[model samples]
Target: MKKTITFAMLHFGVAFTITYLLTGSWVLGGAVALIEPAVNTVVFYFHEKAWKRAESKQLPLAA
Candidate 1:
């Protein structure tokens, strides 16, 4: 949960900052900020799944 929130905030800040710098529009910045979290969530879900698969494959088997 905490990881999710942190990742979302990080993505949101980056997206908002970039959008604001390029367009100088608060409305667009706000929209990008809103969209960032949803995008991060989707990305994180796949990332976590991939990590889990990798970890499981590396686990030692019982004798």
Candidate 2:
């Protein structure tokens, strides 16, 4: 729980900083602040699924 919250804050801080830097509008920055995390969360879900599929296809190495 603590790790999740820490990463959430870290992600938000970095996303907000870059968005504000590029747009110079707090409204736009805030909108991105909300949207980027949601988009990434969905993308990460699919990415992990793909990684699992790839891992399943790999053969075991010799000892």
Candidate 3:
């Protein structure tokens, strides 16, 4: 989707900017920009799964 692509670009730019600003290395910045999002995606998937499992275990309320 266009929105996803644009947001990904925005995330990459922000990550690269902050890392580069702190470390003064484009290579490290680029690496983190790519790697952090990938790691975050995996983490997010597990986080969602955990949340779903938790929600499913919740008891229903009585009327």
Candidate 4:
């Protein structure tokens, strides 16, 4: 839990820093920092589902 929290903070800080560097707007940087991760989490749920489906479709090798 502690690791997860720290990683989340690191992610937000990096996101904000990069966005701020590019755009020079605190509002946009903060918004992107918050929104991108939430959206990525949702996208990741479907990404894992797709990966699982693809893995299930693979044929096993015969020894």
Candidate 5:
């Protein structure tokens, strides 16, 4: 969770800085900011699902 949030924020900051420099418009920068979190959420969701599936396959035998 923390890793995902950090990754998202880093992406947003870099993108926002670049967009602000190129466009000089906060509104556009704000719009660009939305992309990072959306992408991060999708990535994290899939990552979690994959991890869960892998973990489930590793169960030990019962007595």
Candidate 6:
């Protein structure tokens, strides 16, 4: 989706900015911009699965 692509770009910018600020190396900044998001994507997938599992285990309250 178009939105998803831009969202990835935004994350890249953030990662690049932070890494650049800390290390002052373009190569490191680029590396983190790609690697960090890749790692986060995997972590986020698992995190979402855990959240869904927790939500499913909750009982509904009586009205």
CA RMSD per model (angstroms): 3.1, 3.0, 3.2, 3.5, 4.8, 2.6
Question: Can you list the residue pairs that collide in candidate 4?
Answer: none
Please estimate how well model 5 matches the true structure, expressed as its whole-model Cα lDDT.
0.82
The 0-to-1 C-alpha lDDT of every candidate, in the order given, reads 0.86, 0.77, 0.81, 0.80, 0.82, 0.84
TM-score for predicted model 6 compared with the true structure? 0.72
On TM-score, the leading prediction is 1
Model 1 CA deviation exceeding 4 Å by range:
59-63
Off by over 4 Å in 5: 44-63
Give the higher-lDDT candidate: 1 or 6: 1
Question: What lDDT tens digits, residue by residue, belong to model 5 across residues 1-63?
Answer: 786777777878888888989999998888887886678667887898899899989969898
The residue-by-residue lDDT of candidate 1 on 32-60, one tens digit each, is 88887777788897899899899988968
Off by over 4 Å in 3: 1-10, 61-63
Look at candidate 2 and give me any clashing residue pairs: none
Model 4 superposed RMSD (Cα): 3.5
Q: What are the TM-scores, per candidate, against the unseen true structure?
A: 0.74, 0.67, 0.68, 0.64, 0.59, 0.72
5 or 6: which has the higher TM-score?
A: 6
The order by descending TM-score is: 1, 6, 3, 2, 4, 5
lDDT of 1 at 44: 92
- State the lDDT of candidate 6 residue by residue for 31-58, as single tens digits: 9999998677667667778898999999
lDDT agreement of model 6 with the native: 0.84
- Please identify which of the two predictions, 5 or 6, would achieve the higher lDDT against the true structure: 6
- Cα lDDT of model 4 by residue, 4-36, tens digit: 456567778888999999999999999999988
Error of 6 at 50 (Å): 1.4
User: What TM-score, to 2 decimals, does candidate 1 have?
Assistant: 0.74
- Report the candidate with higher TM-score, 1 versus 5: 1
**TM-score of model 4 vs. true structure:** 0.64
